[model samples]
Target chain A: MALPPYAGPLETTWYYGFRFLCACIFIFLITPILVIIPLSFNVEPYFTFTEGMLAFDPDSYSLRWYRDFVNNTQWRHSVENSFIIAISSTILATFLGTMAALGLSKSHMPYRSLMMGLLISPMIVPLIISAAGMYFFYSNIGLDQTYLGIILAHTALGTPFVVITVTATLVGFDHSLTRASANLGASPTVTFFKVIMPLILPGVISGALFAFVTSFDEVVVVLFLAGFEQRTIPRQMWSGIREQISPTILAVATILVMFSVVLLAALELLRRRNNRLRGIV
Target chain B: MANEIIGGDVVLAADGTPLKASLNKAMRKNRIRALLLVTPLFLFIVFSFLIPIVEMTFRSVDNWQVGTLMPKTTTALAGWDGKALPDEPVFAALIQDLQAGAKAREIGKVGTRLNYEKSGLRGMITRSGKKSLKVKEGPYKEKILKMHKKWKDLETWTVIKRNTAPYTMGYYLNAVDMKYDKSGEIVMRDENRRIYGKLFLRTFAISMAITLICVMLAYPIAYLLATLPLRYSNLLMIFVLLPFWTSLLVRTTAWIVMLQSQGVLNDLFVFFGLVSDDNRLQLIYNLTGTIVAMTHILLPFMVLPLYSVMKTISPSYMCAALSLGANPMVAFIRVYMPQTLSGIVAGSILVFILSIGYYITPALVGGTDGTLISNQIAYHMQKSLNWGLAGALGALLLSSVLALYLIYNKIVGVDNMRFG
Candidate 1:
């Protein structure tokens, strides 16, 4: 907000001071993330900028770390594993969560709040406890260290986002359209495909993206449940941070930052689309 | 009109059933259909998520090793007093139990369980199990006692006798750094062995610190976001959302890159002549690193709720206070701050709960002194293979979080919770 012309010097100083404080906080929020993008390209294997880099010498920058990340079999395999696990879990979580959300949004659904709580407990409960619990139970069932176990665990973890997002979309939903479709002699299945699906598609897709990110970024469960063959990107990054501090990790981090940017843009688009569908924008 | 005809205070459908009854039947059908749709995920969560946590919690007291593995010995010890070593019949039962346990190759679990209560019992049990197999005749007491001097100690029998029940508080006791003394009275562990108590306190302290710091940093930014024009605010919002959207490991790695001794922060400090170049400040892998990294990571959580709440607060409240002969700072504090208390509470509790349960950031950056309780739980699970202790620690941490979560639900309402 701009200051009024009648403002005193003290108020003007406070306004500028507040803006300065906010700018500092914003820098604190973003600098750590932004600083690594350039550091990742350092020709020298250092976390800080060299004199040459600060001076803008072209020799100070290189794609060596990115090349290393691409050439490493472990990193490549982890990327593959991350996608396989994240995608499979996202599909399962979205399906189960969407159906459950539809039911939850219905007024006649029994124990609706209780059921919602139970469904979303995965997100609320601490990741370590969930991981520990699953570790023991999966071991008992001979599922630990398997792709199925990791996928199942992540699916359980991801469903809450889908449920929440889809349920949110359903909150502003008009029931008359579905009833009108039925009155027009459309079957329930056909009405769902023609009406309900198009309406909630944005919510479902955004929820799926959320689930994908949740599973993709998850490492605690993977640490407990995954063996070497099932190491995800975060799992590899965990060890990479713990065991070896290297520029390759910076490259990987930069790539992940870009990936999240894409995901964020997609989610924002879905949100805008949802608002438009609801005629709020 | 025939579909619902009013007749003598009751309406009739075309099929002649009362309209009210038909409507009730339809509602019941719809309810059942809704329940059916929810059942698959409900059952899936119950089996996969809820049941596993319940089972893990049960392990904290699931003392089956001594009761099951040494069943004969447990039965024999039933009649004996813990005042002294057992009699001849007890030794005979012990020999039989040991022979069975060793032959089945399941006695090590018993050893491991007992080792948690009292040291040396694991080796004693395993050694006696093997030595008992060689005993073919009577006078087994002398043979067992000779096999291990621990057998002669009254505390050994006491430990075993205490664990003979199907369930014991031994793991929970150990989890809190308390144990039964030789005389069977519960007492705090020795000074050097006591860890979990301090770790629990430190976890709370660190979480509280992070929560307070996040609120402090988040308030001004969130306030700025709430008051700014939509376009600028949305642009500024990315600063918060980018980190929120980024992978957790990526942020942590970025923190490590920035906070390490020779990392970006130190280099900047050195360039500014803040300190001598020879001795860079130790920042990462310590308490500073954890607090800094976690605050940055959890800051967005604080900002979003506060921003949403602040956006709803009309600025006229502060203006009215200003018009009523109040100074700008005083008016802002009295009028504006009180309105945002709900947001402050919601964000504080959210950040606190998250930081309390935080593991990875602390593990990667928190060297020996800075780690939280979750890292300890992981250690017990992975390295020590002490599942019972891990379960106990997890249960304690989970209970606190659930209690806080209930409070959060009461205040913020989980249904209203949204992620960026």
Candidate 2:
């Protein structure tokens, strides 16, 4: 329903130019990030220069940095910690968030709008304060600096994402299916497990995946609560970037972009199979 | 009768079952389902989140240490003033309080901590503490000077005794940039150093500007996507989602890299022969760059909502108007644009709310010029160790967001919110 400005050559040229500018800008904006993907393969220490230029030979690309990164202890530990936090936070956030979404969506509730906002405020609340509060409060609970501390903190932060995604999925759900199951002499628990769970399970799984990514990528809060030994990948990357503008970080970023793409693709595949899962369940 | 017969319940056909038992069972099932569904969230709120926040809010007001000990002294001092230096009995009580406050290390700590709550309190506490330091001998005025020279001013002494009051307007008042007098009246600080209110205003203005810019850029693109064929529309959609899948750090870093002096953007312009070599194109380290990059990042946020709403609108409304002899532009303006108003409102409010709270965008691109209220909140928490001020700023942000959200919910209806 967009109105074209005019048929005049000047106006049309301007519109065409502006649209082209937008497309070019979008491509230009993404180049810095995509540049790293190719640069990762470069046989060079420097970011801007290649080794072949100095050697007077044909330029080459290889997996030297990838090999170094795989063997590095710091990188290995950071990846391990990221995995541990992501898995734990995803489980806890998904469980709580899915339940909350289902409950809030019911016909009768006092101030569901208010409740939803309050529940999701953790997402909106400047996380530094939450991180600060956790620093002090967790110290007393004897969870600070341990894996449990980071896990709980990440779960707290990630649950809102799960709740939002699952809640949105609930909007399109057919409520009568649950009623039909109950009317068919199934117990409420059996109905939930057998009928309702299957219908919304895509949402739940997607929510969990989102929560996993949220926890994995979070840095500022981790900066507050995470001990050096237990630091996440993002936290490690922050230190790396801040301390040294190393080429290794570019390698790391490229690797991470690949990892996230794979995870997202897996989630998409699950979403596509949602109908099959629903039928089986 | 015929319609009812066709749509009749399968379980019964003899003039339909009364089904009271079945209806009640269904109701009970729903209630159980609702409870079962909500329990996980309630438990999370109670344990993981609510408890910690409650603890912090409690600590914010609490004279916890003083509440525990010398309860009477804290109570009496709350009623006293620091005018014209205290008489001997206050000095005697003061001596006892200082010794107890030191031995317990609570009194001076709170005041010192309160100083962190407001910047001016640093000098105020030091002046007050030195003035109020107990004289062990007679001739207390000289002893006060001997302990600390600034204690001679009755005004300086007033600040000391006022701060020393165990239960006082010290922390909370300071949070809002107000301070208490000897008479315990709250007053604004001197005009030259007024900073808090200015920062608050600047924060809101920057957020609003960014929101407006994002909407302007996104609306035309969103309109194009909604009206275009599925092939091109889907291709554009893919581009929008690509940014979402990437790392926030990577996106932010890319902006830094592009906007840097020696980066690709400047190189491109120079290569095209548009700008001279060594052209100083100031992009990053300013408010403009913050707006540009943040708008880029947030543009898709505006587009998705608008596009979804536009997709549902039938083109026939505009077609009908055009056939009725309304000009094409007039028909589109009158019919098509109004249909997308909800999307506009939703996108605007969403972008505004998100942009206002954004910390990293401004920090990376805005540099000194781009720092917003959240940046100060972060500064207070990380550097100053003043949780009170940080908490106060945070609470203010929450209230503003909540108020706007309530308005948005009322006007637009949160129930219809998509793209969650």
Candidate 3:
């Protein structure tokens, strides 16, 4: 958007002003994320930049917080718990959600919209309500305070992402490919493994990534259902922020930000692959 | 011969099965396959998610604990009139019930259930349970009234009688900031005890404010991205997607670091002589902090949908309108803004719905007055151990969100939802 030579002075002024405003908004969006990266490395216990840091002193920065994050038993336990819950829930959610998505895409499925609504309700319902409901119900069944309870709770929460993403992928899928394989005398299993999997694998993997992230970041349900032994990364961060603000949390946040960067890159690549496969690009 | 040939007419497949029957059979098989594929997840959700929520709703009204704990008293109270305190039989039943409850160590639970309706009953019940063992003779009514003067009040009897039923609306009543007053009429709670209604209103107000701020911040950027060249827009999109991909805890922590009184923002202000070091603004741990952090976190949700919608809108409409003798501002307001209304509505509703149910950002920075209804629900579930009231509040929040979601699905179509 270059200014025309015949443009009035007011139009030019407005154009420059608008761009400046958008620039500020962009700064607002990205600065919070970028600011923490430096603060996470600050040697001072303060959340703000210290005078030494402003003067370009190398002594102002250290890896002690990151080391603390690793060496602390509580943080290590939560990291382990996070991976265990996220990985297990992701597997269960992907399998069940992919199957349900397969079923949903079929023209013969009954009451499709209603079923989709029911499957996606967990995502739409407020987390507090779900946690409250699950607390009373799970406690009654003796499932609360157990690892299995948190995993199952997360599985329920994660399935909606899998269902949505996988179902989106299946929308572009060519159903006749499966029919063609079957007509060539391949078994149903063989057709799925050979013809269908190749096309929808990107969607499945991205959906699995979404499920993994959802389970990894979720805290409210964990707060309600998890015992001390089952605390995850988000749960630990939650308590840390509530009870005390520590630089180690910033270190942990920095690491999680990096983890999300990797996940985001993978998702973007998978999205591009999907679009190319569908000939949209 | 013609009639016989017409009557005998039929279609058949190569396997000698009728075409209609074979088609029906194939359709049935497909339906069964689809059902089979969906059944596992369906049953899993029902058992793990749906049933729990339904049971929570039931728990809100399921007040059988008092009645069950004092079964003999409940049966005796069923025959007594509510005009005055009950006769000796009701008192004897009460004493007998207290002795049994104390022996079982369940009297405290009964007191807690009743205290939600009538205050001060918990202490009365607990005290009476301890002293009931000392009284072993007749004339229990006078003895009970002597033990606790609250026994002489007819309001206590009304509350106990109301809760003795298998089902009660006391929790739901309390959820809306109302309760059953004396004479069994529903009335508003006192000002000091009133919190939920105010919390709900505050939640709505804060969410609306966040939604408005997000739209104001996002509109120009989305418009810029939409109208810009592809290379430039793609480069600038990282600003949006990076935050979208980052952990929520990290963003919130960033805000804490930036907005705290002695944090970077205040430091910058002080360095610039904007304000003296003696009086830094109280920025974090308040409503301002909640609004700023939530708007920052939710801005991506607003921009993505608006950008997607704006991308489909060609620039030629504005060009034509401007060329047709209309000013650029008028042309934009008339032509471009109307086209973007759907996007605005979708983004606003999405952000509003998300903000209303928010727990983390508010819990972190929303000190006392800034906390929303979700925080209160969490407080009840964890701190107060008031499960029934928590369920009632949760049920209300869930329904509002579900209602909005249904409308969202109807208008925008959930299948079109996308993530960056």
Which prediction has the highest TM-score against the true structure? 1
Give a tens-digit lDDT track for model 1, residues B1-420. 345877787888777888988888989999998998898899999999999999999999889999998898899999987887899999999999899999999888999999998899999999988888889998988889998999999999999999999888888888788999989999999999999988999999999999999999999999999999999999999999999999999999999889888888999899899988998999989999999999999999999999999999998888789789999889888889999999999999999999999999999999988899999999999999998899999999999999999999999888888888
Candidate 2 wrong stretches, greater than 4 Å:
A1-25, A39-68, A108-111, A183-185, A267-281, B1-33, B57-82, B103-108, B114-142, B160-192, B273-279, B412-415
Alpha-carbon deviation at A23 in model 2, angstroms: 2.2
Each candidate's TM vs. the true structure?
Answer: 0.98, 0.84, 0.97
The 10 consecutive residues of candidate 2 chain B with the worst lDDT sum are B1-10
Q: Candidate 3 residues B311-374, lDDT tens each? A: 9998899989999999989999999999999999999989999999999899999888778989
Worst 10 residues of 2 chain A by lDDT: A46-55
Better of 1 and 3 by lDDT: 1
Residue-wise lDDT of candidate 3 within A1-281, one digit each (tens)? 67899989999999999999999999999888888888998998878899898888999999989999999999999999999999999999999999999999899999999999999888898888888889888998999999999999999999988888889989988888998898899999999899988898988898899889889999999989999999999999988888878899999999998998888888888888988988888
The candidate, 1 or 2, that scores higher on DockQ is 1
Give the residue spans of candidate 1 off by over 4 A: none
Ranking by TM-score: 1, 3, 2
Lowest lDDT block of 10, candidate 3 chain B: B1-10
Question: Which of the two, 2 or 3, has more DockQ?
Answer: 3
Q: Per-residue alpha-carbon lDDT of model 2 for A189-239, expressed as tens digits?
A: 899899888878888888888888889888877887788888888887777
Stronger candidate by lDDT (2 vs 3): 3
B-chain TM-score, candidate 3: 0.97
